[model samples]
Target: MSRQKMLARALIVFALLGACGTGARLAAAGEFVAEARTIAELKAVFGQVESRTVVPARARIGGTIREIGISEGREVKEGEVIARVVDDKLTFELNAADAKIAALQSQLDNARTEFDRAQQLLARGIASQSRLDQAKTQFDVIVSQVAAAQADKAVIEQRTREGAILAPATGRVLTVPVTLGSVVLAGEEIARIASGQYYLRLSLPERHATEIKEGGTVLIGQRGLSPVASGGSAAARQARIAKVYPEIADGRVIADVEVADIGDYFVNERTLVWIPVGERKVIAIPPAAVTTRHGVDYVRVATPDGPLDVAVVLGETFQDGGGPRLEILTGLRPGDRIVMPDVAP
Candidate 1:
């Protein structure tokens, strides 16, 4: 071969080797990359909004409701009269008792006169001792009967006063089960009154009960209301866990959360409550970097050995003005290289 041909062949070989080296360098530089953040974390317990109903306070005595002092939805103080019962029989009994007392007084006056006369006759020896004793016994018996009648009258008056149903506590009237002039039976519910102090009862999964403690702080949010951003802009009421019901029902443990600042809203069984477990600071990454497969969560991290697969335990999601990020519970640390979606994996 000629020297010029040999030199051209050597040049072509060098060119091919240079191209292969460049391709390998590019391939080595290309790996998945992700931007991560360390975020302040908080745990929020979510609950549903609910309206509560007031229970009826029953009347102790049966009578016709002649007067209703308050209407439905009226706020009443303790011991305020809500309704009055019209009981003519009680009134008549009282009147008859008074008449009987007056009649007894006249008969006692006559008996006193006869007893005095009998005493005089016995002293003058014109009447026997037995006659004097008889007059005395008659007077004592009449006085006793009069006292009994008066006692019966007093009882009737007391019962008549009790026939007027009064508000047992300070609360708002939720319902009027009986109308004016309606006859209510004894111990019948006249109206339902709701106390201003409200309590939030929550049924949580039984497993969560182990983590909950009495007096723990609880955040109550109306369910259906828009989720609040992670800042202080949202309105959330706070409450304390007053008690934990010892029994479990329907696979949930019952807990009572007390909220003293009860507004003019009705609460029912559907109310939701959010209990705070605790707070911690953790490393966070974009949700896109994390992927789930076969019910296990994984993330690709850049390492000396190329893209490395990491299994991570996830914490709460933090959403702020800058958007949302996922908190990493484990298997991740600060300064770890995480894959960003735009980078080729």
Candidate 2:
């Protein structure tokens, strides 16, 4: 098929997704359930998923990238060699340094012999003391030169050994900025990696700067562990605001929200976050009263006349003396008793 036909078919397929009627069901009498309580109002906002620890792999010296052993999105171990830097020039310099040391050592040996001979002659009164002093100074200078040459060679060898870039921490590679034969400067970043743990990065409007505080509650809709629900991991978990930035940027205040099951999310994934800036009254019911069918949530209300089966939009689940309860977003009202699904009319 032609490209245009394929594109048109794809659009049509997408347009046909989730084709269903959204209507509530009616049921008879059931067990009595609790009511929703008005709690802190959560303000929904957009946020990004990011790793808590970002590790950057850098080059120790200015050289061309000889080889890259890892690719983007690959997991790496701590201290594992991921890339090599070409340092042929340093290798040649190191060889020269060794040769210089060898030459200096030979010169020092000859100087020592001459100094011994001058000392013997001066002791036998056949040579002046000044001659012995000159020979001693010459021997000492040659020794110092050999020591300096050896020290320089050691430095070169150390740098040459450091040509291999190792991962500082175990993590999934985010990006390999440099490829084979890419010339990178000393201390330049060659790769970026994420160190496992992830969090929600929220950018709240600066108007709520004062309202945003550490330890405040947030509702996160994403993969992994839920911050609020106990035990089972829910897509929408209650999380707490881990940090609130002191400074505002571009009319926004940024904050970090810590959540569990960070391993389930990839870095930089976009998600919706809801933060409770203040509290209000809300209707809630016990979790037992809510039922799911075909992925839609519903609840039953108990009226004095009979058990009214009302379709309810489920909200945040909270706990009081009555244990875990679900927030009724719609289709219910205050003072309406709810019935558990297992209860009979």
Pick the TM-score winner: 2
Per-candidate local distance difference test: 0.72, 0.78
How do the predictions measure up, each by TM-score?
0.64, 0.72
Counting clashing residue pairs in each candidate, in order, gives 18, 9
Q: What would the per-residue lDDT of candidate 2 be over residues 216-315, giving only the tens digit for each residue?
A: 8777776433443222222457788899888888999999999877563377876677776777777877777777777877765656665555777876
Candidate 2 TM-score, true structure as reference: 0.72
lDDT of candidate 2? 0.78
Worst 10 residues of 2 by lDDT: 18-27
Off by over 4 Å in 1: 1-56, 222-238, 269-272, 276-345
The lDDT leader among the candidates is: 2
Displacement of residue 16 (Cα, Å) in model 1 is: 34
| Tens digit per residue, CA lDDT, model 1, 1-345 | 999999999999998887566444444553333335544323344443233445567777788898888877688887888888777788888989999999998989988998999999999999999999999998998989889988998899888988878888788887887788898888898888886466677777877767678988766655333354422213455678888888888888777787765455454534345565445567777777787878999877776865666899997665546566677888887787775544344
TM-score of 1: 0.64
